[model samples]
Target: MIVITAPTGNIGRHLLPLLLEPVPDGETFRVVVRDPARLSDAVRDRVEVVTGSHGDPGTVDRAFEGADAVFWLVPPDSSLTPMDAYCGFTRPAAKALATHGVGHVVGLSALGRGTPVAGRAGLVTASLAMDDLIAETGVAYRAVACPSFFENVLEEADSIRENGVFTDSVAADRKAPLVAVADIAGVAAGLLLDRSWSGTADVPVLGPRDVSPNDLARIMTEQLGRPVRYEHQPTGEVFRTLVGHGLNEAFVQGIVDMKRAKDDGLDAGVTRTDETATPTSFEQWCTETLLPAVHG
Candidate 1:
């Protein structure tokens, strides 16, 4: 059996189907979700949906019972401090997997994880810590260190529709690779199913290419048939704008710092393509995913 945590999330939603497609007849696939009722009927019918929180030791133990491999993802939201919440939640779950004798673990993490930055606010730092913690459990592990999500730009779609522009604190010329969430999930599903590699592995999911905000704007314009522009917000003004949108002070500061780091090329490193590298181009993602989500 293959157990999946956070199976209702963006990456997990895509991953479950991939994992199930190759299963031989009569095999069972299990999913751990906080609210099993929220899962779509199609998915609920195909997988064993177990209700539980990833942070609860008892819940994780029950979910991991009889499971051979697990796909784990940390929930990303505004409520929790990334470092404390991830460690507190994942530690017990990792222990459960260890105790249950699960064979493999696939963890979702981020790029720029191990690299130190002065004002990082510990988001990526916490992920690296989680990766290390999972490694200590002695299960075969693959950490999907993904770059920025192409879907992140969707958050600004409303503004783009109204203002004919996309805005960010990163310079218009700074280039960073952004992978689609679906690609991250695809790579993760492959790792969970293979069960061939041992020890800890860092799989960086670089999208098809690196593109700047200026390039993104051009792509959007060409695809949407509208003259969308790229605008660089002043660093001081960026924090105020984020605050106005109801972000907390700490998160707003973190966003500003992350943007500054990106502008300085902190996230510009490119890793050699791994076994799980089916790259999604920004244009391909925009046309097939982003545009439909925005217009439909």
Candidate 2:
């Protein structure tokens, strides 16, 4: 059996269909979810549902039983500190994985694991630590290391529509690899289904090329058929803005630190090979995803 957590989330939602299109023979699917209602009737009818937070020991214990592989993705809790949000949430599942003897795990993680700033990159640091905790469980783990998602721009759809502008904490000219969530899900699904690989490794899912904030603006302008510009916001301002939205102060600060680390080239260490370079590009994503969001 293969288990999936956060089946309703961005990456998880995409990952689910890929796994279900034709599940391999002798391998059944299960999902640990908080709200079974969020699952479609089609999905609910197909997979075993263990209702509750996957972070809960009891939930994972039941879900992991008889499982051969697990797709692990931690949903960030804005009410908790970054450490608690990632590591603390994952601790129980780590224990359950070992106890259940689940052999393979595909997890969501950020880029910059081996970079100098990685140790100080707040939420990214915590996520890497979580990877370590899972690795200690002796599961054949694959942390799908990723940079910023092209879909992140959708968060600024309203701003783009109204003011023809989008904002970020990174510099306008600073280029870093950005991926589409669909590609991330595709990579994760591939790992979860293939059990031949053993030992822990990071499967980097960098997109076709590195893109800057300015490049994003250019793409948005061209794709949306309007003038769109990039606006750089200070990390501190981002922290305050998010905190004002009622998020935990520490969690907001972790976002700030992560942005700072990105600005400092935290994701620039990896070389994009044929395997690491995913198919989607910023322009393609802007046309396919962002354009619809701005105009729809």
Candidate 3:
């Protein structure tokens, strides 16, 4: 049995179908979510639904019972308690993993190590701490270290569609990797299904190549056939923009700090080698995901 948290999220939503495709016959798939209705009919039909927040001990205990491999992600809590979001949320579950004898845990995290900027990468710092906490449990773990996501561009759909303009917090030439949500899901699903791997590890899901915000603008312009422009929005503005979007102040600032960290090279860990390469390109993702989103 495999237990998935945040099943309706960016990566988890796409991951469900992929996991179902090669689900070695008779294996069980279960999900713990606060609102079961958010899940699609297809997912509801396939997995056992435990309708409750994963932060709640009762819900996690109930959902994880008898489960083997588990997919984990600490849903972004807008509350002031996000420092506790991963550790607090996973506390009981970590115990549950040991008590239930779960074999593997696949988690989502950011990629930034051995960099001075990483120290203040807000949510990322907390997430890395969470990874350590999970690893200490002695359960075999794979922390998928993701860079910026292609879906992040979708957040600027209105600007791109209406005015061929988008903004970010990084410099024009600061190149960093960007992974498609589908690829993150693919990595997690592959690990969850295969029980051969053990021990704690970090799987960096670097995209096909590094790209700057200007490079992204050019790609978007080419894909949309419009004169797209990229602008470096200040960190203060990034904080305001996210807050205006209804994110909690704390969460918004975490994002602001993350952007600052990125501009300082938090994700500059790729050398274009096949080993660091992921399958999707920014253009391919724009065509398949962003193009439709912006056009819509």
lDDT of 1 at 160: 75
Residue lDDT tens for model 2, 168-281: 999899999999999999999898888899999999999999989998888888888999999999988898899999999999889989999999999998999999999988
So what's the TM-score on candidate 3? 0.94
Encode model 3's per-residue lDDT on 7-123: one tens digit a residue: 999988889999887567878899998888899887798889999888788888888889888998998777654567667777888888877788899999889855777779887
TM-score of each: 0.90, 0.99, 0.94
30-107 per-residue lDDT for model 1 (tens digits): 988889888889888888877878778888888999988888887754455556556767999889888999888989
- Candidate 1 residues lying further than 4 Å off, grouped into runs, are 25-27, 113-121, 234-238, 241-248, 272-277
Clash counts per candidate, in order, are 0, 0, 0
Off by over 4 Å in 3: 243-247, 270-272
List per-prediction Cα lDDT, in the order shown. Answer: 0.78, 0.93, 0.85
Of 2 and 3, which scores higher on TM-score?
Answer: 2
Output candidate 1 Cα RMSD: 2.3
Best by lDDT: 2
**Global CA lDDT of candidate 3, please?**
0.85
